[model samples]
Target: MGFKSLAGKFYAGIVQKQIEYQRKNAVSLQQKIFLYIVGEAATTKFGTDHGFSDIQTYEDFKKRVPIRDYEELRPYIDRVISGEENVLWPGTPAYLAKTSGTTSGVKYIPISKQSMPEHITAARNALLNYAYETGNTSALDGKMIFLQGSPELYELNGIPTGRLSGIVAHHVPGYLQSNRMPSYTTNCIDDWEEKVEAIVGETIKEDMRLISGIPPWCQMYFDRLSARAGGKKIKDIFPNFKLFVYGGVNYEPYRARIEESIGFKIDTIETYPASEGFIAYQDSQKDNSLLLMVDAGIFYEFVPAEEIFNENPTRLQLKEVELNRNYALILNTNAGLWGYNIGDTVKFVSKNPYKIVVTGRIKQFISAFGEHVIVEEVEQALMEVARKEGIDIVEFTVAPQITPADGGLPYHEWLIEFGHAPYDLKGFALKVDQALQEKNIYYKDLIKGNILQPLIVKSLKKNSFVDYMRIMGKLGGQNKVPRIANDRKIADQLTRYITN
Candidate 1:
């Protein structure tokens, strides 16, 4: 506690200065950050193409770079991967983060030397903000175990490539690596279950104070630890554990189980770290809204989610953004990604303080037959049912069921695993259908027109999602269930798993 108190005090001071800097000139600081990145890489092919030398202001820069997605930026990234100098950034990209959030296949994203610190600093400040806001520094004193992908690098072209978490783990600054755990031996285990077992064995006796991971995987860790320790709760095993940091999924569904595992509640912090960069984090103690990472070497843009697929969508910079509207996120970063759409949709929760809530992803949906049910609608519907029935759900995914014959009706198929199952499957399915119909007019219209049948709800055995993810080789760390898929690929796989 003494060591943590001192470190917290030091880190808090740095955050307060950041707080002041952000508070004073958020929009202006973002503009300057953009210019600094452009100026540094001005002689590069991309910079030259975008008229980087003539761009003096946000308005000027906006016209030069057209908003794009990963496919659109692949050419430049390919050049960088081939060891071409000054293709995008001033020098070769130090690393590439291969992520699958946008599709079933991987998207190769560059991590330039300039952008690497953005990841580290954003994470560091998230902790600093927690300490400053709550006046609790004990977490800094003990082992801060981060459950992330292994740091082992794989080669693609001439560059090192891995998941973003693995890359971050590899680049952990010299000062914090010694204080972090599990042992290097355990951390390098590529298999998630094996890693969890090793981590539990290594960490069970340590004076651990902080735990960070995606919610479901961390829940699994806590469950394993409790079972190994004669069924005692996490607090009984690691009594000093005071902070739980989580992200990479919506925390609502798994929160209660995690708290129950711990035997009590602890301060929880949320962050929005994508493969591209750290987007936002929980900076206040009072609410769930995340503070935007404005000055972190990333220039931000937002296109109204409704307008995203339009031929010529309006892309709004920071100042033009309005609160409470869903917008697809875009980033032009020091990483040399220009006008790239990272595919996330976020709604501003607070304009005066600049806070946001990640609503869903651009490509995640069940739009079969033009019903167009989005993740937000599905989550809200499930959440409503959970609240009404007093049952906890571990995870769920949706896929459309289309009829092959004219006499048959098309419908939705749901694969759900419950933390605690509800007794009435029929009634529960009715409620969920009603909720979705209420939330989505297209869905209701389809139902009213007899274009779609009532949704089919299938109860999965306990740990079904875990097993499904395990089979997919994505059982831990930052991996998450795809909320919705247009086709039956995910649903079909889950069906096989459930039957067996």
Candidate 2:
């Protein structure tokens, strides 16, 4: 058999086991995960200090380790960086994923030897699940063009650190590596503009079969590829392109733009991989919900989104979460992230198979006037408006314009970068305003009470967000335009450089 067939069979076997285990029983899965983690990490300092030795049950485990975010793990991570062994896990981490610190400067997420394989396995299974469920192996026979981050890795006190996609890229098996595009040299380009040009030159004529990356960046690539083809859609450039694997941000708003770039509809698979670990993925082509990776070397916990910011909040285990409620994710992974808050919100859609959809980031919202507009709501509103007005937006960001100097009442300021501008800009903005009012009562109340004025919409010059991300040094891969800023900090900054 060919290697692709063999690999397909191998991935099929593993994914089958996963789907079966995923549906076996939530309680049993959780128990097994707890035992696996404690057993593997019991020798580590953090584990032993937290009484992993005597922790025979979930209650015991939870009682010992309080929930934490990256801030709370700073000391331990610092120790690990300083060459400490077994600080959080059984041994030193193989690498640290340098995540976007737009909120906190930079976050170094440890990827231990034990946990790295689980991540790879989970990623592998995401594709395998898609292939198996669809009964299509054409993608396996063709090359994949993963629009990954910089492939360059840097060292921090003897440990490797870089974007997670970059770190993971270095480890793609030799067989798959041969089928990958953007050659290692091109992937290492640190500058986004230069890198995309180089990638366009390299893969525009290649028999690329799959494309994967954050939606905004992918749109940039597709646009450039179309330009290279003399205005032909990206599908003309890559006829074999079958699957578009994406994650890290909402895809709803970008779907129309991406499909337009593709010249037709295409299959897509979504992943929920945080810097901490691969959490969940779209397992079936028939549905939109993602299946949780229940057996993927991570113990899961959930805290109701409403109570997550409170002084004390109840943490709910896997089976304890109800359907259709936003909950913040917590993880106790084999990587030694003990009860760590990943900071993304999700809502369950199914219990029989434990399916979920990512809602938004815990910190990614606009709430300057108590009108808490979240990512999901804003994205849905944008999509709804775009559909209504026949407009195509490349990317956008919203923030509260709270400077009373502009007007007495604060208003939401949107800086929208468009691929195709609407003929009726005013009507487009009005539709978004009405849609958001329909979705968020607090925002409606603010407008009704005259506490906030109507939203201010600014059409940005093409490539505004692109230029901004390039300036911030966070252009490609999982990096994306922040949908909502806590204040006008980012909005004002972008406006200074990109007024249309």
Candidate 3:
């Protein structure tokens, strides 16, 4: 395949130069003021359009614009559907990306033309940054496949809209366009059965090198590919494949199974993506943190994680944030979101102002007993225990359930899937218990008195998680099974065999 089909090498080069420049000069006084102005301007527009005309200055904007949840924006969404002139911004919304929330079954987040460019630029920068870091820019010489949601667009009258993926795929450089699979048009919204069949059929015949999308869907595709090829590994299906880019949910649970099916530890890159924008992405070889796209037309704020659940919370400016501190993210972006508490928490591992680790979702924490344990704490505990035990865990989830002991205090029951099962399951459980004790002293104290005994380890059958997701109607798409639950609903559903 001809790699350099377009003379647009300049675009890539320019992005490279900008990345270097921003790395060295991202936190200067000028950059700070520029970001402040951008944030204020975005907020002003957001407020004015939403009937807060008095929000002209920064302080006024801050006071008048309360942090909005998606439910609060339904009125504006209705206006957009009615084809109002200025429902979101100055122009009509070009696209509405559907995303699900805890309360809202499905939401259509309006995407304007102004927002599309930022998504494209951030995505391109992420790809280029990976290439620069790994010295593998030519990886694009082969096909890059995204196992994403149905690419269909929906009309106002409920007609099948074409695939949104195909629409975005077309925007890539023409030189690299041929490397896309299932051509966007054909992949657009079709019948679910037909879409899966087409994706699987074409993927098996193609030279797919780079794969990207939600982890659950990718696992489903890998299973389909494996079965189609008569139990062949994913590496055998795409011999030239080297990278697996996943985001939208935690990859820890699916990690072991995916590597086993692929027959190798494929280079993995995680991202934090949403319908509003692509917020952050892990680099080629970095496990520390994801680098934020500073030039992606989004200004950010950080509210201390401790304050997120408070009645009166204080938020920090980008300049005021520190490394290793968990902060609930607030974004002011070109997508018409201003001071938007997108309900995600992140922690900085670097002070360069552009790199941070996504700790977890704000609402995804397990606090049934008011211990207020976040996902990061659980992940840390798991990683530490695994390291100490000299084992590799593929996936795990913790659920809070009541046992018959001591009048029903909430206790944690862990479901862990290990790459290699230990001969002594009791010892493994003890190590996990000790690790959690060290991280969370309260849990340790409770364990000593038999308030929460070390729970049983229930090893899942091969591909059990995948089958469970399939039953939930969340397989083969954007929906991801949560890694930590406040209650046992999902855990019970996943662990029915063992529980029985």
What TM-score, computed on C-alpha atoms, does each candidate reach?
0.95, 0.95, 0.86
What is candidate 1's lDDT per residue for 1-500, written digit by digit as tens? 47657877787988878876785687897878877988987899998888899988777877888887888788888788888889888887888988775453777789988888889988888888888878888876678899998877888777898888889997777767767999878888989999999999989999889999999899999999998999999999999999999888888878778888999978999999988889899987789889898888888989999888887789898889998899999998888888898888999987766789998888888888887798888988988888779978888899998864456898898888877878888789889999999999999999999999888788888888898888888888778888888998888888864532
lDDT of 2 by residue, 84-133 (tens): 89989877889998986665568898998877887788888888877777
lDDT of 3 by residue, 1-500 (tens): 33441223445667778877766765563255334444444433354564445544445655655566677767766676566645455556677666667767777676667777767777767776676666665457777887665555567533222334534654666656778776675466444445666788888978888889877667767878899899999999999888888887767656767888899988878877677677777764856378776656566778898787676678666667888888999876655666677888998888764688888888877666556667877887777666666666655677887763466555677776666666677787777667777777766667776666654566665556656766766655666666777877877876763422
> How much does each candidate deviate from the true structure in C-alpha RMSD?
2.1, 2.1, 3.7
lDDT value for candidate 1? Answer: 0.86
| Clashes by residue pair, model 1 | none
Off by over 4 Å in 3: 5-11, 25-46, 49-60, 157-167, 184-197, 284-287, 386-395, 405-410, 417-421, 449-451
Whole-structure CA lDDT of model 2: 0.84
Candidate lDDT (C-alpha), each: 0.86, 0.84, 0.68
Look at candidate 2 and tell me the lDDT of residue 406.
52
What's the C-alpha lDDT at position 388 in model 3? 61
Task: In model 2, state the lDDT of residue 387.
Answer: 82
Task: Report model 2's TM-score to 2 decimal places.
Answer: 0.95
